[model samples]
Target: MTALLSRPGRVAAAFSPAHIGRAATLALHDELALAPKPGLVSFEDTGSHDDMDAHTFMRSLLALRSYFTHMAELGAAFAPFDALERSGIEAEARMLAATGGINTHRGAIFMLGLLCAAAGATQADGLALSADHWRAALQQHWGAALQARCARASVLSGGRAARQYGLRSASEEAALGLPVLFECAVPAWRAAQARGLSGQRLQLQVFFQIMAELDDCNIAHRGGLEGLAFARTEAQRFLMNGGATRTEALTDAREIHAAFVARRLSPGGCADTLSAVCLLHRLGALG
Candidate 1:
């Protein structure tokens, strides 16, 4: 049986490796459950990519479950940054093998994997598992390493696109302590919650907010600067027109989804940020 830990006004769960794994899995599930997400796969439909669907994402999730737990364990042990990077590399290969070479959760694997490690690190130090705490720990422990790694050439499509378009790569985001998540996405989520939004509506609100502001390289890779501009403009319009608060919000989102599919554009970076937001929510770090 899983153990639990308690604190004043908040219950702190025991830092079992499995607990960390479950958090990652739950975050992925939350992301998948959110529907009408433009150019992203969910239970209702396959977004822009014909190569992957909800089921394909499930397979990738299963393949990486152990990786999250193991990485957390490594972090609890205070493993070096290179060690964590190697662990993610192996997990990425496993995900590719499981999904027949389609890259579904590579971005999630990197961002969420680091998050799991940060969680473990925080727990190891008996610190409260809040978003601010984890973000600070992640920077303290791996910021330099991430910056150095970002300086090297990357062979991944997203990294290549980021360089070609002069956008921020995932590694750069990590080095900067995930500015989109900490600065934009999380704040949007909190504001939505304050306004009494919950469930899928709340999730969509956060997703759109991130999409509007993020320099999503996936969009750049698929549609270049013009495509990225178009995507940001659409997202900004959605937020300005009442976002998920209006009765017609879901309908508008579906239209956006259709438009993204038609363009073969995917705001995958935003999707990753959404997943991170979900993770933080699950961990009660958003509070």
Candidate 2:
């Protein structure tokens, strides 16, 4: 069992809707606070985005505060995916209203929300809060439904682009148990922490690692296949050269940020994945 839930009394409190929801919100906040992010928003400045910024993301986070809590509540009741889907739809509406129709956390509402639900369900089942257990809970409870949803067509631009480019959509990633998060991003985070890195350096290491790997439908939508390839290559080169450990790592990252912004490219999917890693770390799922 994880330390958070090792005690009997602590389990209920740990699994509370408010606590779980707060963790989800804080994870997004952590992601937003990371600077020198390639083609992403931060408290310092907006990168490659005129439609949204730190303020817009804050509004969306505030609006979503209750939605994640509600999802956990539903999961504790073992509610079906249809119920969760309805809740997500409602939450998305609230987010749009808060951000004036800007889609800042749309992907997060799907990815992190599901993780929160699974965390609730896992705790309710008296299981460990490890990544393995949470993942199992998600698959056991919602895998079939998610797979069915994945097979359907998406009218969204990102989804359309994924289809056009023969890349895996976010829906497909979720249905397959979020391999990028579980298989790639989490490991990168663990490796960074193991190297005794802290704060923004650790975050930068993981973010660049994700950017190098994630197929990022957002990149495809904005920059197309060529753009996606360029982004992957740049991110990979950053890691190969020295990543965040180098003395001039921040400068190099800022340069990459400038390049991405110049091309109007934003790796939103990678950003969402980074937020997922934050959530997992907060939940004690990242040893």
Candidate 3:
């Protein structure tokens, strides 16, 4: 495996631009390939989204390939937060264009974009590209800026929901170094892997773990606080009942999917975190 980080002077040769790009692409693929995801898109169904399907996700992913690579390159060059945000804006525009204005990967663009940049910074600073390295780099580089950004009122659905519900916005999550991803999602994923899980089973286990803990604004935006609570409770129940290890897991997940769709609820924030976990795993950062 190619290390995403190396000694400062040897950064360029440690990881190729294409390698960073592939990491992002593969992470998106892993998210999409996870089937029976409650209220989320998959190869088998559209989940909660009426405007997008697996193909729509593919188009959005194609549009973002260059964006992820560019963000990594910028990070490697020690670019500022404004530069990364600018690149993300351009990437978001392309994604919207590709999906006919549907917001398929906006959250992924922000979360994974930062991760990619942090990966680049870690390599540039001559550190190992571990999860801690990425977290430290993000805090050192853009933590204050992200906190400031969260102070402003959000015009987006998720942000607005966060404010209205008094829940943590994605900006706040980023500002806090994505505690949900590092402290919750990744550890659960690694434990599942250690237990010999893989593929969709592994993904579903991680997804439910995220859903159970995160105050997912998408769920709030669509379903309100009551819906968010209900969703969280259901997710907690799923995990308490043994998650993917149980024979009833798939049936239970499908039931939740049906319920969420009926209420127009989507745990998009959890989905985004899952993608980040997948990326970190791919880059060998989770360990």
Candidate 4:
């Protein structure tokens, strides 16, 4: 709710690399703190996986604390795509070491890291910290590289599933400036705030919206195409039934969580997208 830099002010100094990096880290925390996230790990429970818990996420967060800030600094300098990619690769190595080889935030490391860089680049250009400016900076700086990257074969499970199912890979989403994050998730967050919603309820609504829209490779990798479809349908159904406004909303969400865990369907992409929403919120871009 506090914005150090917004459209009217455009305070470049306020959008420092450390500030952006801290925001990105806190955004990941915000995402991790959300409970009943439907097959994702949380403080109250590990929704699906036996391999990870909240402590693992905490270690990952600790490892990634400075990565985003560094990325932002690189972006402010107008560094090339290869530089950002190298930074990300190094950060991923730290994350893996921290989590003891568990992939706690691989998707977020790529997505949010880019956005953090884009935000810094936008600030360097004297642009407002609005979603549009950040996204444009991303496209202007690394759009072509991301597009080219999408064409390469990926050995990662999520990427392989995306390729096999003909779904849009994360690289494709990045090349196109993360349409779901900007077009869908950000708007949904604003709409929820406009509806007198706040706190976890607000986050839940936005999370469901992203889940309903994203072709989550994690879900596909675990549950295949059918699992992906099921997750989306369930998310849509949650939203249709009054979303977080329902009197029994938490109970309903928990039920959905149980179902997803039973099938091992974690909508990791949606979780990453929600973290992006949190980053924008922290940056004062949502207002």
Candidate 5:
């Protein structure tokens, strides 16, 4: 008998890209504009400020990080999925997964996001997507041109990746009090580089506290913002344990992050708990 650890995948050749026309892109934009997540609480009609306007309970942190990273790595990843050579690209994405370099769970999530984006370019079907059929999300696009691209991808890859990781539907961002996006690169990356920044403990601590607040909101309600909060708080604790220098700013910042961590909004198991503690040792959030 084969061990479960060495079992074969139920699905094969999970995701691949298909040629989509110009209209597909437009349809994708429409989907972004119209897609909604069920069980969303306290929504803001406007798409402004990711901080307070989105729903996030069913959200997967690993998925969102890939979403951000895929946007970051589009140049490297897009080649395979390009319309001209999608078959080759799809093969490559699969190969990358086989090599264990690509994150299997996240890779699927990335495809779902792209496929969903493509689906938005069409009005092919009027079928509202449930969690299961989101890979076939084109039905909900009202039969737009983007649905054609989605259909193509579905036909080629059988929508395995889309179906596998199409767990959360995108919705309007929540802006509890913060802005839509947190460009950590500003003070955290670029600014530090320019300043030849060495001392970051305090700043890192403050950022952690901010994240804690965000996570608190997520626990109170359900939204995508929790991931960022989780990442931030973890980063803070790791910094604290590192024995960072005590400066006026640094001390104050550390206090804030520490305070947030001290307040437990939800119960976390080893993974979440350890991660929260792990981050304080780092100099700042990213580094």
Candidate 6:
């Protein structure tokens, strides 16, 4: 348990009331129209999931995926008595869906993160994985996890989940950074709080530092820009039970080749993705 608790993103202590209050406050905001904050996550309207060429689109997705898993593990660790944690987790899921798609392994990582964060796993309590490290792990291990989750969601939620996962394409991952992700992530977590006092922002305060530590989780597995194509081919070939073979991993190298072709739209995609990332970087649940 100590080792598990010590995961890079894990919190060393329990969250404070004030922190929780802040989380609740922001999470419940009425979708205020604020200027496009820039940081952390980066997306653009130009390319579809299929259009994400290496570098930014692919790398960001890779990072987001890992963060999701670290965060999910953190949430599952916290066995709570009320809905505050659970509700927040659900809200995180919504945010990920709107911001990050769950089609590819990286997107799945974000899903995992949202659920875990919602469960109330503060950096103080445990779940210690950096965003980068976590992303590396997910990029490395998420294939198996995605297959498993895809199958599970398919069976439980019906084919709707499976088809949606299929929509993830090769792009649409998040970029969780140290300075941006950790420095600003807590406020988003604080907003996630379901029920709490006014101005205390306990959830926000606690989440502020906690989400930042998640940076380790983000870059741990690093398959490189080339890995995205491989992952995509593997996804196409083997999924759930069929599974991706080593040869198929190579076969998918075409995705990278294709990435170069589509990169013309990077600038726009980068900007939009950044907009969402910035919001997430500063935004929290508190809902």
Best by TM-score: 4
Q: Per-residue error at 213 for model 5, in Å?
A: 11
lDDT minimum window of 10 residues, candidate 3? 4-13
lDDT of 3: 0.89
Q: What's the ranking of the predictions by lDDT, best on top?
A: 4, 2, 1, 3, 6, 5
TM-score for each prediction?
0.95, 0.95, 0.95, 0.96, 0.25, 0.27
What lDDT score goes with residue 221 in model 3? 95
lDDT of each: 0.89, 0.90, 0.89, 0.92, 0.28, 0.31
Which ten-residue region of model 4 has the weakest summed lDDT?
A: 1-10
How well is each residue in 1-287 modelled by candidate 4, as lDDT tens digits? Answer: 22344455555445678889999999999999998899999999998899999999999998998999999989989899999999999999999999999999999999999999998888877787899988999999989998999889999999999989999989889999999999999999989999999999999999999999998999999999999999999999999999998889899999999999999989899999999999999998988
lDDT (C-alpha) at residue 39 in model 1: 87
What's the C-alpha lDDT at position 28 in model 2?
A: 96
lDDT per residue for candidate 1 within 239-284, as digits (tens), equals 9999999999999999999999999999999988898999888877
The residue-by-residue lDDT of candidate 3 on 1-287, one tens digit each, is: 35443344554335665687789988998998887777889899998888899999999999999999999989888888899999999999999999999999999999999999888888777777888888999999888888888878889999999989899999999999999999999899989999888878898999999999998999999989999999999999999999998888899988988988788888889989999999998887866
Candidate 5 stretches with Cα past 4 Å from truth are 1-184, 202-246, 265-287
Instruction: Report the Cα lDDT for residue 126, model 3.
Output: 78
lDDT by residue for model 6 over 1-287, one digit each (tens)? Answer: 12223446545433332333233232222111111111122122223334332233343343343343344344445433223234434544554464454322232333334433433343434433334333333333333333433333332221332243332211222212223333344343334343342232332122222322222222112222333333334323322222112334223323422442243211121222223233233322221
Best by lDDT: 4
Where does candidate 2 clash, by residue pair? none
- The superposed Cα distance between candidate 5 and the true structure at residue 79, in angstroms, equals 6.6
Residue 5 of model 6, lDDT score: 34
